[model samples]
Target chain A: MRRERRRVERADDVGPYRLLRLERDGLDAGEPGQFFMLEAPGRLLPRPLSVCLATPAELAFLIDPVGPGTRPLAALAPGDAIHLLGPLGRGFRLDVERPLLVGGGIGIAPLPYLSARLGGPPALLGFRTAGHAEAAALLPGAEVVIDPVLVTDALPSGHDVLACGPEPMLRALTAIYPDAQLAWEAPMACGYGACYGCAVELDGRLQRLCIEGPVVAARRVTGASTMRAGR
Target chain B: MIPVLNASGCLDALTAPDVARTLDAYVTKTVTPLPREGNPPPRIAETDVGMLNSIGLANPGIDAFLGEHLPRLAGLGIPIWVSAGGFSAADYAHVCSLLDTRAEVDTIELNLSCPNVDAPEEDALAIVAAARAATVKPLYAKLSPALPNLPGTAAAVAAAGADGLTLVNTLRGLALDPATLRPRLAAGIGGLSGPALRPVALAAVYACARAVDLPIVGVGGVACGRDALELVAAGASAVAVGTALFADPGVPGRIRAELAVLRGRVPDPGV
Candidate 1:
C-alpha cells in the first residue's frame, strides 16, 4: 500500500546521531539495517536513509545533521511531520556462526540492532579513531580496537564477518575475508527494481540496491555506481 | 490538488499485474496518428547526470488506441491526460477531437518538445491550433528544458491558446556500452531521471512560471515533497512524478505527507 509514513514520535542524540522514530499503522515488519526513503520537507528528491532499528508499530532512523537534507532532519522534533517509504532494501544476513560484526561512525548505528537480531554475544568492531567511541558503545559486546595503524593486522581472523561503514573500512574487510557476508550502502534511484540506477556487480552479475541487496555476499560487490544514495 | 502522474513515455506503470489499483493516474504512452512502432531498438541511452530517450513517439495509431484501449481505462477516477503527438497540427487537432468526446477523458496534452519525435516546432504550434479548434476542454503543452529561450517559447504557447504547460520532458541524450561497441539500452537512448534531471527540470519550471500566467505542471525528477514545493514556489500549479513513481509507487504519498510537515501542519496520512 502506498501510504505516507508520518513521524509520530522522535528522540534526539541516540548515541551519536539524531534519531527520528516514525510511527505508522500497518503491516510493516521492517528488518534491522534495512532502510526507508524519507521525503525531505520541500526537496526535489527523497533521501534514502538507513534504518537503525525496526519493529511492527514503529520504524527508526539514526541520522546526523548534514546538507540541505540532514539540516531539516536535525531541526525536526516530536509531532513534526515527515513521510517515509520503508523496509525497502535487503538488510543483514546472520549465518548463525562466527559473525565478526564491524561498523564505523554513524554506520555503526546499525550494529546494536544487528547484534540483537543475531540472537547472541559480542563481535569485534574497528573504528577510524577513538573519538568515534559512541558508535562502538551503542552495540553491546563490542571489541573496540582504536588506532588506525593496527586495523589491518589486529582484526581477529577465523570468523564469518558482517560489516557496514565507509568504503575504506569495507574494502579492508573485503580483502581479509572475501568469503564473509557483507552489507553494502549504495545510492538508490528507486527502492523498487525498475530504474536499474542503484546497481552493483554481484558474482559477475548486476544487483539492484532497492531489490537485490543493501545486503549481499561479501564476494558480490564490484564497487560500481549508476546512481546517487540517500542519507 | 488532483492526483495525476506524468505521462513520460514507456514508464511501465503497468508493471504490476493490476494497474488500476496501483496508480490513481494512468497517462497513456505518447501517441502519434498512425502506427509508429518508434525509433529503432537500443532506443534509450545514458548521460553523466541524466539519461536520454529516443523512442520516436511509438504508438499503434489513435484509432486503435481509442477502440482497443479506451474502454479498459474507463471509469477510472483519475483524468486521462492524453500526451498527443502528430505529423502535423491537423493531426493533433483531429486526434484531440476524437478523444474529447469520450466522457472518461477530458484533458488533451500536446507534445511540443520531444527530442526523439519528428514534428517541427511550427507543426506543434499548428497542432495546438488544431486541438484548440477541435475541443473545448483544456489543452496542455509539454515542452523541453533544452530549447533556447524557454521562457519566450512558453509565452508563445500561452499566447497560442494552450491551457497549461508541462515543463521539461526528458532531455535528449546517449549512453554507450564499452564492450558491445553500442548503447546499453535497447532503444540506444532513454530519458534520464533521478537526481540528474532535477536542476534542468527546476530551471524549466522557474522560467515557464516567470514567462506565462498559465498553470504549469512540473515534471522531470521529483521524488519528494521538497522537489514538488520547489516547482510550486517557482509558479508550477502542480508537479508530476515521472521517474520516481515508477521506481517507488509510495513516493507520491510520502511526498504529500512531507509537504504537510514542511508547512508545519501535521500531516494526516489517511493511509
Candidate 2:
C-alpha cells in the first residue's frame, strides 16, 4: 500500500522488449499474476508492470517501450531510483488441478511467475515471429508458437487455462475457454481502485481492473473492442 | 473533528477497505439517477504536474448504489458522505430525498461541476435549495474552480441552505500525443487535478472563506501534510485528499501525522 523508491539492479533488452531487474528492500515475494506500478522521474503516472519474476530481494518486469509511459523505462540504468507501488491486484486463482499457462507477445510477462507457481506447467508462448519468440527463452520450457497460428488452436481440453495478451487473442481464447482466468490491461490512472479510470464492462456492470482484478474470469468480460483500444 | 476526507471518486472504499479505514471519513464517488457507462478508452492521461481524466462519472445508478454499495460502505465504519450528481435540480432533490431516510448516510455532497457532462447552466443555489428541502442532514456544495465568481456563488449556495462548501473541482485541460498529434484523451478534454491546481484551490478557498461564513472543504491537489496545512492556512476548515491517493494509499494517515508535527513546530501567536 506504500510507494517505495527502488534502484534498478540490471537493465537488458530481450528481443523487442526491455527487462529491468530492480533491487527493493522489504519487497514482498508477490503472488503470480500480481503487478506493480513503476514510476520514473519526469513521467506523470507510473506504468503498471506485471511481475515477471519476484524473489526476496529483487523483482523483474518485461516492458514494451511502445508508448510514452513505457518508453522512458527502457532508459533506466542500474542504480537509478524508480518508484514502485505494488504487489497490487488479485492474482490468479491457483486452485485448479492441471492448469495450463498461455501467453501471447508481451502478455507473457506474468506467465513465468504463473508457471513457477504451478510447478512449471507446460506453457504455450505465442509471438509474431521467431525474433519476437526469443523472449520465450525467459520462460525456461515454454512451447513456442510463431505467427499465422494462435496458441489457442493448440489449447488442450480439460485443463484449466490462464491467459494474458492482446485483446483479440484474449477474446478468441475466451470464446473457446469460457472458464479461463485472464489478466487484462487498461489505461489505468490509479493502479489501485480509487479512480474508475481503468473500468471494464463485465456482465452489464463496470468493474475496476486495478481492484476486482487485473486477473479476472474470461466469461464475465464484455466489449473486447474497448479493452483492445486501451480505454 | 473530521481530520481529512477523500473527495468523491478519488478513493473506492469498497475495493480497498483497509485503506478506507485509515481516512477520517469516506466520500463515495458521484452517483447519478441512472447508470452511466462513462467515456471510452484513454479516459485518463498524465500531465506534467498532474493527471487529466474523463471518467464521465461512471457509476451504478442510485438504486444499485443504495442496495449494493451503501450497505458495504457503511460497514467500513467511517462516516459516509454520499456525493450525488445529476443533470437537473430535480435529480439532486430526488436522490437526496432517498438518502435522507438511510440512517447510514452521514452527509450529502452535491457534485455540480462534472466537466464531461453536457447540462444546462449549473444553478448551485437551486440544487442546494432543492436538496435542502429533501434532506435534513448536512449538505455541502462541491463547486467548480472555473466558476467566474466563486465568492458570490458560495454566498448564494450558503443562503440556499448549504451547510458547507468543497472549495474547487478539477480544471478542464487537454493533452496531445507527440506522434499522432491527436488528443491524448478519448473524451478529447479531461479535468486536471494534482499539484498544478493547488494555487487555484488556495485562491478559491481564500476568496470564499472571506466572502461566506460557511465551512469549506478544500480539495484540488493535496498529496501531503504540508499541502493540507496550506489549505488550512488559507481558511479551509478541512482538506480532502485527491490525486495523491493514487501514489500513496496511506496518504491520509501520513498527512494527519505530518500535520501534527507541523502544528507543534509553529510558534504560538499571542491570542
Candidate 3:
C-alpha cells in the first residue's frame, strides 16, 4: 500500500546520522533490531533504517543520509506521504532478566527503548572520538566507552550484555564478555525471511538475521565477520 | 472479475490503510506449526542495488490465526492464501494439516526457503516433501532465487507433487554505517529483494517453466504492469508483487487491468 506516511510526515534528524521519526503522536510499531525501508521520490531503492524507539503513536528511525534514497528521506518536511515498510524483520529479545546493555555508534538508538522495556540496566556504550548528541541524549546514566581502553575499563563482571553497532566494538565487547547477545545488521531484499542474503551464524547454523535474529548470543557466532559462510 | 493479487506475502500489515482497500488478493504472513516470534530484528539492511531481510517465520500459530486474525481477514473481501512453513517435512505436514481445516484459508503457500529453526542447515526439499503429504488444497511452495540449481529444484518440487510454485525468494545482501564502519542491520545479513532481483527471479521462472509443467507464480521485483508482463513473457502464469508492493500498494490492481495488454503481446497458445 502506498502509505503516504512519507508524504504526510517528514523525518526529523535526531543525531549521529539518525534522520527519521514517524512524527505521529505515538504510532510506534517498531521494535529494536527491526528496520524501515525509507522510500522517497526518484529514489528506487529504499534506505534501510533502524528504529531506536517505537510507541503506538510515534516511530523513530536513526539513519545516516547516504545515497539517493536517504538524502531525500533526510530532506522530508513535517508532513509528507511516506512509503515505508516496517517494523520489518525481527527485533531484539530481552527475555532474560539481566541484560547488560552494550551499544556502539548509532546502534545505541535501541538502547534506551530496551532499557525502558527492560526497566533500565547499567550499560556499556561505545562511541567514536567525539560525542554525539543523539547518543548522549538517548543513553543517560550508561557507562560510555570511546576506545579499547574504555571498553577494557568499562565491561562489567557478571551481567550478560546485549549490543548493536560497529563490529570492532561488538567484537571487542564479545571478546570481553564472550557470552553476550550481539545484535547484527544485514542488507535485505524482502523484510520477510525468504532470502538467505541477510544470513548469519548462530551455534553453527546459517540463519537469516531478518528472521532468525538481529541478536544472537556471543557464544553462538563462529566467525568474526558477518554474512558469508565461515568465509 | 475479482482482481488477483499477489498471493505471496507482499503487503506489510503496516502499509497504508487504503492499501487494504485497494488490493484484490492480499496473502497473509507465513504461518507455522507453533507460533513463531521470527528472527531477531535489524531485520532489514540496505544495499547498492536493493534491500535485504530475514524475518523468520513469525506468525501466530494456526489456532490463534483461526481464532484471531482470520476473522479480521475474512472481512477484507479478498481471497486469502495462507502461507505456511516448517523446518522439516513432518513439520510442514503438521502445519498444513491444521491450516487445511481452517475456513478463511482458501489456499496454502509453502515456503521453500525456511531453514530449520532448531537445526538451520536443512534444505528446501524437506518442505516440498512435507506439503505433498499434507493437504489436497491448492498448495504453492514459494522458492528462492539464490538456489544453486533453480530449475532442478523446481523440477524436484514438481516431481514431489507441488500444485504450483512462487518463483524467487530474496537474494541475501548487506549494508553498513560508514561512520561506525560496521554492518547496518542487527542481523548482520538479510535477504535481498527489489528491481535488481527481477532478472534473477525471471530467469528462474523461465527455467522452471521449461523444467516442469506446473503453473509458476513469479515474484521478486514487480513494481508495475510492465514488470508483471515481463514475468509472463518469461513463462509465469501469474506474477507476485513483493518489494514493489511496499512502494506502490495499488500496483497489483493496476497490473491486473493491464493484463489484456500483455495478452496482446503474447503469441497465441493455439499457434
Best by DockQ: 2
Error of 3 at B138 (Å): 1.4
Number of clashes recorded per candidate: 26, 2, 70
- Which candidate wins on lDDT? 2
Sorted by TM-score, highest first, which candidate order results? 2, 3, 1
- Candidate 2, residues B54-136, lDDT tens digits: the string is 99988888999999999999999999999999988999999999999999999899998888877535488888999999999
Candidate 1 docking class: incorrect
RMSD of each: 10.1, 2.8, 8.8
Where is the poorest 10-residue window by lDDT in model 3 chain A? A1-10
lDDT by residue for model 1 (A1-231), tens: 353657658666754467777775663646666767777664544566766666666666677665556667766788987767666677776654777677756666576668778874556666656656555656767777765543456677778777776667677778888876666665444455444445556665444556767776666776443322343
lDDT per model vs. reference: 0.66, 0.85, 0.66
Higher DockQ: candidate 2 or 3? 2
Tell me the lDDT of model 1 at B139: 87
State the lDDT of candidate 3 residue by residue for A1-231, as single tens digits. Answer: 233353334465455465466755434465666666566556554445667766655676665555556566666666655666666666777677677887777668667677777878887777765545356567688877675445547766777778887676777777787877777765554444433445566676556566666676677776446642110
Tens digits of per-residue lDDT for model 3, B225-246: 6777777778887777776664
DockQ of each: 0.07, 0.52, 0.13
Worst 10 residues of 2 chain B by lDDT: B262-271
